[model samples]
Target: MIQKIPPGPVTMSDWNFVIVEYQGHVVEKFLGYYYELQHIRFSSQVIEYDPQSNTGKTWSGSKYFFLDRPGPLYPLAQIYLAHFSRNEGIRVRLKYQG
Candidate 1:
């Protein structure tokens, strides 16, 4: 299911919820959290990304895996939001790799 992020500041982490692009559509999946200084194992499901609308369909029961382990998606920022804050997550931008 696509977990809609609330309107506020947020951060990305390993095994955390992520929205990525796939086949010309944006998808939300739970692979691994952001660890170290790069995003690794971007292998998971690619739901559907609709920037114009705020709606989601049922699960498509599909999965995709990317072998690009270029480290964390974003760099550690100097500050972070409360909702976006985590024990392991650092203050950084949320990057979606399709």
Candidate 2:
């Protein structure tokens, strides 16, 4: 019998991965994953994968921050504001969803 590999643990993908740093000190890191599933909001809480359990759980709430600006907005501005208010560096990475 051929052994089968179980599915990988849940992880946020195809969004932005940001590392927050303040005054040369690492504050926190956040991962944002967005997807449209059946026209409903499908967002991951952005958690670290637990290899043993094959699941992901919320790591740190401070790591992720959501913007609630209204009207037209720019991506750069949003990021900049987030940095200034949150006081952290950001690293953006694309997540691959199959």
Candidate 3:
């Protein structure tokens, strides 16, 4: 389900939520905060998307793991909208690799 964010100022840490189905089943979820830094570099090749921008932007030198599951589809993405502030919002992007 896709949801639009309301207008207001919100903190980064307060923008996490869970995904539920019609029968109240939790498909997947995440907990984290977004930050705006002058510069950030990672040690691994794969890093998650920046919540602020909805683009497929990636940082170099980052280390992260891809969570996956066994299914007919090899990979799938679950996207969530996280509002950090009324003017600034982020999309919590999740990719299922297993």
Candidate 4:
């Protein structure tokens, strides 16, 4: 599933398995569908920019949190792992037809 990212908040609905890392270290790995996941969210939020500091670090309270409020982002190359058995390529099933 590949698509152009829009210039707005992007929300992921049905997804599982999210790996969070920090400074090349694995912080946490979420393993479960969207409905089963807890606490954290998977929506894109805006970063507040400050002209004086010449940096953006602020976040919206609605979808963003820090420390106890939420978390941060980083740069890394994502690698997906799939089961390679006699079944062949990655198996996918659609729940919606529309």
lDDT of each: 0.34, 0.33, 0.26, 0.26
Q: Please, what are the lDDT tens digits per residue for candidate 4 over residues 6-98?
A: 333222222332333335543222111122223223323234523353222213332211221112221111112222112443332212211
For candidate 4, the per-residue lDDT at 87 reads: 40
Whose lDDT is greatest here? 1
Name model 4 segments beyond 4 Å from true.
20-23, 27-98
Q: Which ten residues in a row have the lowest lDDT in candidate 3?
A: 37-46
TM-score of 3: 0.18
Candidate 2 error regions (>4 Å) = 1-11, 36-47, 51-55, 59-98
Off by over 4 Å in 3: 1-57, 69-81, 88-98
All candidates: TM-score: 0.23, 0.27, 0.18, 0.21
Candidate 3 residue 32 C-alpha distance from true site, Å: 7.2
* Predicted model with the maximum TM-score: 2
lDDT of 3 at 47: 30
Q: RMSD of candidate 2 to the true fold? A: 14.3
Inter-residue clash pairs, candidate 3? 8-86, 42-61, 42-62, 43-61, 44-61, 44-62, 44-63, 68-97, 68-98, 69-98
